[model samples]
Target: MNIGFDGKRAANNLTGLGNYSRSLIAQLAGFFPQNRYFVYTPKIKNHPQINRFLSIPNILTELPNVPGLFWRTSGIKKQLLKDNIDLFHGLSHEIPLGIHKSGIPSVVTIHDLIFLKFPQYFGRIDRFIYNLKFRYACKNSNRIVAISEQTKNDIIEHFNIDPEKIEVIYQSCDDSFKIASTDQLKESVRLKYQLPEKYILNVGTIETRKNLLTLVKALKQINEDHVLVVVGRKTKYADLVNQEIDKLNLRPRIIFLQDIPFNELPSIYQMAAVFVYPSVYEGFGIPVIEALYAHVPVVAATGSCLEEAGGKYSSYVSPFDHNGFAKAINHILDHPKVQKEMIEKGKDYVQRFNTEIISKEMMGLYTDVLKLHRSQHSNDAQLSTRPQRSRRSQRTSKN
Candidate 1:
């Protein structure tokens, strides 16, 4: 199979969709080496991280012969045909226009409908454009891959897509997260990041939807000495969160980290006393899985797909419930037995998202779509080749 992907995110964005794109391609190449893979990007940067993917034997990187916008809109179809792509997968929410007309089966992965779900967070014009592209992609693609069941249900509810047309495939954390960090490694990371001896960790973009202010409020209720360490890119929301911290006089207890090297993340997760995710919504909470993989007990907000990501063993509280969040955090910290049980269960549940398992499931979907496409083409060919007969002869034969 000559498989191609819209590698814009994989080549540019370093987190979320980029991680998903890079991991998917790498896993497929590692496990299914027989198939050739093509990654289409408008431009390639000098980043060493993304450049390493080019070394894979059966993998090739393709660039546009024309301008970048032209490539993304319509020129990509020509490249797909030129490369003899058997299948195209849009790693993000969209596929190129006219891809279906080019006689290629395509799959689009819709991460979430956050803009539609929370309209106030996005601009009207941006939401309108996003709605147009997403709806068109969902309607045109041969199949849809939702990162979580919650996302899959959202697609069905928001768009008039068939439930059977969508498949739920969970994403996994980096392989480094699965490995246990050594005591020495943890200590080094602790010193490097100036991490406290015990702290509650939250990892994600510092945005309004992440609900960091609520988490900060929860800290005021807790009587323990656990500091709050936030790790992610800071947006304008950070200023609001900071003001809230100042208003509560909790500045001494809160720490914000950004631009930390990727390799040190596992140690940070392993070293944390507890991992708290208080987001109001998510496509799929990858950090919950990452914390679980590190054997760290998780306490996440209730609502949306977080329950699915955190699993049943992990504790959950309402996103807006400051007392609930505080109580859950204290309970996990105080009870050694409960923490042990949560960690054990989390370890087992996270195996379902191992690269081997997820890769196999994705490969199966690709195979099914390819088989269906071939069968339909064969039927069309047979019908076209059949000799035509007069209307009366056809009616007599039928009678």
Candidate 2:
């Protein structure tokens, strides 16, 4: 089977959607080498992580023959036909316009509807464009792959799509997170980052939706000596969090890190005393899974899909409850047995989202969709070629 993917995020984005795109494509190419895979992007940039996928024998990357907005919207259909693609998958929440008219079965992965859910967080123009593109993709695509059940429900409620058409497939973290790092490697990472001896790690962009200020407030209540290490690009929301930190006099206790190399993140995850994700909402929390895969105890917020990502062993508390988060952190720190149990359970639970398992499920779905498409095409051809009665014969039969 020939498979094509919208590789914009895979080539450009460094986190979240990019990770999902690169991992999914790599796993499919590595595990099922017989199928030919093509990645179509508007342009290619110098991305080291994305570049590695090009080494796979079955995978090929293509740029738009005709550049600009035309390629992004309607010109892609011509390329898909030129390449003889059997199916096209949109790694992000959009597919090219007129793909359905071109008769190419398409699947789209809707990461989240956050722009729609929280209009205040986005600009009016951005929200309008997102709504238009997302609604069109959801309505026209042959299948939808929701990263979590929460996202799937949101799609149904907002777009009125059929539940059967959406599949809840979880995302996995990088393999580096799952592998146990040696003591030397951990020590090197610690020295490189100047990490505190004991720290609570939070990984994500600093935005209003992440609810980082609540975590900062909770830090004042905890009696432990652990620092809070935040690793991500800061937005305007960081200024608000910083003001709270200043008011509470917790500046010395919080560490903010940005632009950490991708290779060193696993070691940093392993060295943390505990991993905390206080986000108020998420499509699927990859950091929680990363913490679990790193053999660290996870404490995530309760109102969204964090529980699903963290699994049964991890603790969940309200995003607004500072006291609850502080208590959960102390409990994990104070009890060695509790930490051991969480690590064991989390390691086992994360296997469900492993690369091998997810790739196989995706391959099965693609095969089924392609088969159905071929069968429909054959039936349409037969009908078009069937004999028709003459006008006189039709009149006699009518009499």
Clashes of each: 0, 0
Give the Cα-based TM-score of candidate 2 against the true structure: 0.97
Cα error, residue 397 of model 1, in Å, equals 6.5
Candidate 2 residue 90 C-alpha distance from true site, Å: 0.8
Alpha-carbon local distance difference test for all models? 0.91, 0.90
User: How does model 1 score by TM-score?
Assistant: 0.97
Worst 10 residues of 1 by lDDT: 45-54
List RMSD in Å for every model shown: 1.5, 1.3
Task: Tell me the tens digit of each residue's lDDT in model 1 across 1-399.
Answer: 999999988888778898889889999999999999999999776676677766778889888867665688689998899899999999899999988888899999999999989999999999998998899899999999999999999999999789999999999877889998889988999998789998999999999999988899999987558999999999999999999999999999988999877778999999888999999999999999999999999999988899999899999999999899999999988888998999999999888889999999999999999999889989999999999899999999999
Q: Global lDDT for candidate 2?
A: 0.90
